[model samples]
Target chain A: MISFLQIDLPALLVGTLAALVCALIGNFLMLTRQSMLGDAMGHVVLPGIVIAFMIAASTATWVMLTGAFAAALFASLLVEFLRRSAGVEPSAALGAVFTAMFALGVLLLEQSGVARTSFDVHHILFGNIETAIWPAATGLSSLFDANALANLPPQVARLGFGLFIVALIVILLFKELRVVSFDPVFARTIGISPRLIGAIVVALAALAAVVSLSATGVILLVAMMVCPPATARMLTDDLKTQVLLSLAFALASGLLGYAIAVLLPLGLGYEISLGAAGTIAVVAGVFQLIAMIAGPKRGSPRNA
Target chain B: MTEFREILAVLLLQAGYNTTVVMLGAAALGAATGTVGVFAMLRRRALVADAVAHATLPGVALGFITAVALGFSGKSLPFLLAGSALTAVLSALCIQWIVTHTRLNEDTAIASVLATFFALGVVLLTVIQTLKTGGQAGLDVYLLGATAGMLRSEAITLAAFSFIAAAVVAAFFKELTLVSFDTEYARAHGFPVRVLDLLVLALVLAVIVIGLRVVGLVLIVALLIIPPAAARFWTNHASRMTIVSAIIGAASAYGGAALSAVRPDTPTGPVIVLLAFAILLVSVCFGSARGLVIRALGTQKLPRRVS
Candidate 1:
């Protein structure tokens, strides 16, 4: 049982947690018609991690997370600036920022000789979940698990918990989020500050993304976040129902993808290449395909 | 002085090789993508190029794997490109079918095809890597290319194919333009719009497949988009735009290669993209016909009206 817990639970827990976090934030992105923004932010986070490592000389999660958030915010601000001031297309602005920032991060990494330790950064873009180890004991114990099972490595639990908090907050303010997502002008007319709501959603999405980077890696996270919700949109008209279905789809994919990845060596003659996060993304994509064919007669009304 | 002269001679010789390979390859790919991309852009299918580009990854990997399976003497660049081209064209058609047959909008169809195909590519690539198959580790480099790998043969093939492809475009330029800008007009005019559309798409995928040796798949969309976008800034006529776009594409290829040669670690794709962007900036700001500066300066200041 202990061996089973060690072998099965870790992968299962991490995959499900990643899917939950991605779904929580993904709904907002899909609603805003900014699904690709996750991909842009994923790349933009690189310069932040690089800069943080330069200054901090440590990979402590909090420092890196803050650095990533700041950089992501700056990039988002720059994208908005380009859109407003320069009249550059939004996608063009996104492409420019991510490419330039990715280049800058590479430059910094090479210059600092941190490339040796930091080369895993590229792998971090796609992720390597199998090698990830459980966190050390934090000395905080849950009454339900006196053996401290609840205190399992933060990596296994943090993403799901973070997502739960985000989902709760979103639930509490569901009306505002929906109004702002669909029609900011009308939302503002109703006394909801659309801009504030939009900013909060973008920030939360970014925070969720930063946490996701620890698991899914950067390159693949956008797919994980966007695909499930986008697929969900195809199956339903109700915005609320879409979110619920997307969560179900995402979590189911995580579990199935993890199981197949684990069973690859035994069932197939060869070992599979993808880790849990990638497998989950692949599974989500499969779900989207099935939904496309078997889905309802119409895609949902525009998120607005 | 003697040492300086010898070194200069060697550098100049190498630079010439770099210039020819880069320019020719970019021009061929640029013209092909431009021709196809015009249709894509006019159809408002800009993102499809991105999707197709991503879609090519697994095809390239599979082609490589097949080449290995056959125990080929060489990497079989042409075969690899052909496979990718086939995959890409099929994927593009699948996207079209999904949009038409299913209730899915263009965005969802495109997103689904793009993500699913790319995820498959990533999964296959990882599996191959884990197998320790004797191949390059950064096969993804084919997705994000560095032009330092270009050789003499690739350049010649690109140049020759581009010239032929350009001639085809020139001969059919009027028909292609007619179809791209207004499919309804082309259809009414008795043009074979569907055939022409497929031809243009075929050419574009061909170029993308071949060009992967240099700029790779990810930034290939930039090649397809930026040159035409920049060229559009200079002219409204499709014929002139195609010509100018080809020139810009080749010139950027040259410029990027030259700069990358001097800047040791610089990847050619980003530099080329930057060059294209720079051209766009210039065209946007200073082009004689429709540049921002001229438009802003020429027009009388009017009271701004908010929507």
Candidate 2:
């Protein structure tokens, strides 16, 4: 139990926080039909962190996080530029920009010899969730202890801050977001600039992606940004209910996935543990699959 | 000076048999992907190819584990690629299914499937690590591509698959062009638009599977995207664009592979993509059809309306 408090608890907290933040922003992304932007942000964050590391020569959390946020913002702007100026199709522009950035990140990782120490491609992809142990925590009392709180994993704090920002944005701009998502033309007629709102939403998504990246890794970050909201979308037509359901689903996936990752191996009499992020993604996918098959709102009007 | 000479030698195929084979294979894969990419971009399924490319991870891992289970060397490229092909097709189908059956849009489906499949692949990889299978170390090469250790047979297989994919594109050129340009019109004319769409996706899958060894799955979509996107700046005619895209793709792959051969420390996949991106950047600036320079100059030369 003590081992669980030190090791499993922090990992679970970080993973759940990452999931909640991603799912929170993901609801708007799905409604706006810009889910792929979340995917693009996930890929571009790699170069941001890599360049940050190159410049600062430090693995400090803030340095890398700032770098990631900048890269994501730059990549989003590049995608917009390519679409508007280059006459490229939106999907193609996004695909081209993100992949090129990712490739650049990988090349830099190799050429700078960063892959030899401190970080590598595998670490960037799978993340270090298992190492996010809270050695300072002694038991439940440590939860309220200032020293223990101060020593919490950096990812937990980052993701918590990200969740706060996302929830704040969603709350403050709920009406504008709904109007733009459902009818951008209507939003523009009503004096709301859909473009500005779109940019803010994209910026918020970038924040969510950058903050969640170190805990969830690239694949799980994308999954969390997509699967929970999609699953909720399948089950409900109401925006408010969908957002609430998605958060619940995200929390559920994180907890259930971490539990399974640790328990399944022990139950099978194997000492090896599964990947927490991967398992969470899988559990989220399972929820999505179930929703797809059985949700009340699963059918389109024509199909119904 | 010596490094320059070595790079030149590799480019000219005078480096050695191994280097020549690998470079040629990469070139073939590039041409195939670039050719197919034009249709995918036209159909607005460029990012869908990304989802499919990412989905190959689990297939590769599953293929390795199965190969070891069957008493074959787990490093067999054929088994691994075959596994990737299965999952790639499955992922594409899942995207199609979600778009058709659910309220979720194609982008959401694509992102979700890409992430979920990739995460599953990562989990399988962890499983492989724990299993302590011999030769499992080689599987990491599929993630980023390490052509420095590619075998002769593997290069031949890659070249052959690439050629077959390209030939299929040539055979269906007109039908594909028709469908991509005007899908509803093609359907009105009783053409099999659905089948043609599937064929384009299949061609994409073929390129991805073969290119997995050269560019790796992570950036293989760039081979399908960057070259065609660059080609778009040079030509408006579909046929001309396809040819131009193929050339750019082949050139980037050949150049990137040769450079990697000269400087073995650099991974092959990213170098290839970076080279493709460089070509894209150049084409964006100077190409004749829609290049920014041409557009800017053309607008300047236009007389102001004297209404």
Candidate 3:
């Protein structure tokens, strides 16, 4: 139990927190028909981290997070510019910008020889979730100890803060976001700037993506952002219910996935654990699949 | 002076048989992707290829495991690629099903499928690591491509498959153009719009699977997107646009491969993508048809608006 608390608890907390934050913002993204923007942000975060590492000469969490956030913002603005100015379609613009940024990151990573040092390409892709251990924790009692709390992995704190910010933004701007997501022309007539709300939502998503990145990596971040909300969307018609249900789904997937990753191998007599983030993503997918088949609105003609 | 001469030799395909083959293969893959990408973009399915590319991961891992289990070398390119094609097609169908059956939009379906499938691939990869297989070391090349270490057989297979894909696009050119330009009209005229859509997707899958060894999956979508997108700025005519897009794609890939040959540290996939983006940047600014510069020039020639 102590070993599990020391090693598994912090990793699970970080992963679950990451999933929650991403899914929270993902509801709005899905409603706005911009779910792929999460994918783009996830891809652009790589270049941001690589550039941050190059500039700061350090891998501090804040530095990398800031870099990733900036990159995401820049990519978003560039996509907008391409759509408006260059006459590019939104998806193609997004595809071009993010891939180019990602390619740039990979190129910079190779040229800087960072792949040979403390960081590697796989670390950037799959992340180091298994290494997020809280060595100071002894058991459940350690949760109340100040020292133990201080020794908690940085990812847990970052992701916790991210979830708080995302939830706060969603709560505070719920009406405006909904109006813009459902009817931009109506929002404009009512004096709400859809573009500003869109930017805010994109910024919030970038925040969730950058913070979740260390725990879930780029690919799993997209899954967490997309799958949970999509599952919730299938089950519910109300936006609030969708948001709440998505959070529940994200939490459930995280816990179950982490448990399966750790315990399944042991039960089967294997010595190795599966990738926790990937397992979480797969579990989230399963949930979505189930909802698609059996949800109340699954076969509704409203969809057509 | 000698370095310059060597680069020139590489450019001219005089850089030895291995280098020549790899460059040509990349070029062929690029041309095919560009040709197919035109219809995809016209049909607004450009990002579907992104989802398809990402979804190839689990297939690759499964292929590796299955090959090893069957007592074949896990590095068998054919088996691995066959695995990827199966899943790529599966993922496409999943997107179609979700979009058609549910309230979810295409973007949401693409994103969810991409993330889920890639995550499964990652899980399978970890499983592969635990198997103690010696041939599992280079499977990551499918992520970002390592053209420098490509086998001769792999290079030939890539080139041949790419040529076939481009030819397929050429053979179906009129039908595809009609479908992309006027889907409703094509449907009314009795063309199998749905099958052609799948055909476009299948051609895209073919390009991605073959290009996996050179450009890698992550950036292969760029090959399918950037060249055609860049070509769009140069010509309004579909046929000319296809030719221009293919030329741009071929040039970028050929140049990138040669450059990677000259500098072993530079990976092939990123270099090619960067080269393609540079062309896109140039086209966006100064192309003859829809270039920003041309637009600016045309606007300047207009008479001043009355107050």
Candidate 4:
């Protein structure tokens, strides 16, 4: 029993932190209906990392993160410019800008073979989260050892720090985010800058994405950002309840999904585990699907 | 003497018979995607095709594995494509289910399914790649696509499929336009709005399937979206838009194939998409209908959002 606890506890920690950070920012995104922003960032982050590598001349972690954020900003502005000046629809504009940029990134990677050597597109998509959770904590006792905790894998530390920053922002300015999400006009009337607040939310989203990518992978980050909040939204109308419920759902999905990914292969008499990030997405999607059918919130229309 | 011959061969597409077949096949695929993609864009559901494209990944991996299990050449295009078509339709149905059954917005619905299905594909592909046979080589082509390897029979199949799809759209032009413009009005006029909607969806799926073996899934959405969007800059009439889109699609595919042929190892999907985008840029700036430059020079009023 003790051995099982030791094995599962660290995974539970890493999954919770990754899920928490994504969900906190995701709730506001759901209310604002800017989920496409998440999609846009996910694609653009690739080229950002590449260009950053070229300039930094080193594959330092901060350089890649900075490059990713800058690329995302540039891509977002380019999308807007295409829409405003070129008269493209919002979706089409995003599709045009990012696919071109993504393809460009691919070609650049091929030119240098950097994608194969460093980026590992497969690793970015499915992630190495299952073992990340386990290997970070060598044992349950180390959880209480300050020096041991300090020596944890960078993924665990980075995700934990990301959650801290996200939580601080949410708590410090909860009401402003709520108002901006619900009604920007009302927010502006009350001396708040909805646009500014929205920008901050997007910035937080990008930061969360940077931290979450290695743990949850790139495509799975979309699920992490959208699924729990979407489920919470389906379950409640109150913003506060949505936030709290989103946190709870994220915890459940992360732990449950991680556990399933780890144990399922063993059950099948094989040693190979499935990708944790994808399994988590599947679990979250399934939860949302079930909630759509059974939740008491207004997911379904009544027969009038 | 060798250098001159190499240049001449590439210029004439004497690069190989295989190259010629692939080039023409790509053009047909391009034309079909652009024409159908316009209606999808008109309905403002342009990104639904993205979901469909990503969703086909699992079907592809499964189809290959299942074929190998049954003692057939797992790399057979037809069987793999059949699997993809089934799964893409299933994912589409799931999207429809979510839209009707949940309060989630359409973008959210597309994003959810795209992410989920794609993740599943990643898991399956990862597993397949570890197998000692077949897995190490074939399906990676579906990721970025390698057009040179396309068989003559496959090229013929793609060309034939594109012609049939374009013909069906041409035949149903009137009904499709009416429903696309005003669904309730079309229904009141006794046109089957739902069936027309399904037809539009099926057309998009067909473009996705035919485009996959060459263009791959991730970039397949570009083929569906970019051509029609570019064509919209040149005209307001539906038939004219369709024509222009087809031409643009054909031209881009031709251009991309030629480029890929010249450069022996370049991936074809991105080249085609980028070419389509280049035409769009030209169209947006200078096409006659409501081109930005033309409007700026006082030929007509500038376009607003939906124009």
Higher-DockQ candidate among 1 and 4?
Answer: 4
B99-191: candidate 3 lDDT, tens digit per residue:
888888888999999999989998998888888768887798898887787877888889999899999988999999999988899999999
DockQ, Cα level, model 4: 0.52
Candidate rank order under lDDT: 2, 3, 4, 1
For model 3, the interface Cα RMSD in angstroms equals 1.5
> What interface RMSD does every candidate have?
3.5, 1.4, 1.5, 2.1
Q: Residues A63-84, candidate 1, lDDT per residue (tens digit)?
A: 7788888898888886776466
Between candidates 1 and 2, name the one with more favorable lDDT. 2
> Where does candidate 3 stray beyond 4 Å?
A116-118, A139-141, A301-304, B1-8, B302-307
lDDT of each: 0.68, 0.88, 0.87, 0.79
Question: Can you tell me which runs of candidate 1 are displaced by over 4 Å?
Answer: A1-12, A60-114, A119-121, A135-165, A179-200, A269-273, A296-304, B1-13, B16-39, B101-103, B178-200, B235-237, B259-267, B282-285, B290-292, B299-307
- Checking candidate 3 for backbone clashes, the offending pairs are none
Model 3 chain B, poorest ten-residue lDDT window? Answer: B298-307
lDDT of 1 by residue, B227-305 (tens): 6656666777887878787777766666665555565455566666666667766876776666677668656454343
Predicted chain A of candidate 4: TM-score: 0.88
Q: Is candidate 1 or candidate 3 better by lDDT?
A: 3
Top-TM-score structure, candidate number: 2
How good is the docking of model 2, by CAPRI class? medium
Tell me each candidate's TM-score: 0.82, 0.96, 0.95, 0.89
Candidate 3 local lDDT, residue B18 = 92
lDDT comparison, 3 vs 4, better candidate:
3
Query: Is 2 or 4 the stronger prediction by lDDT?
Result: 2
**What's the true lDDT of residue A294 in model 2?**
97
Tens digits of per-residue lDDT for model 2, A89-125: 7777788888889888888887788777757788667
Query: What's the residue-level lDDT of A32 in candidate 3?
Result: 87
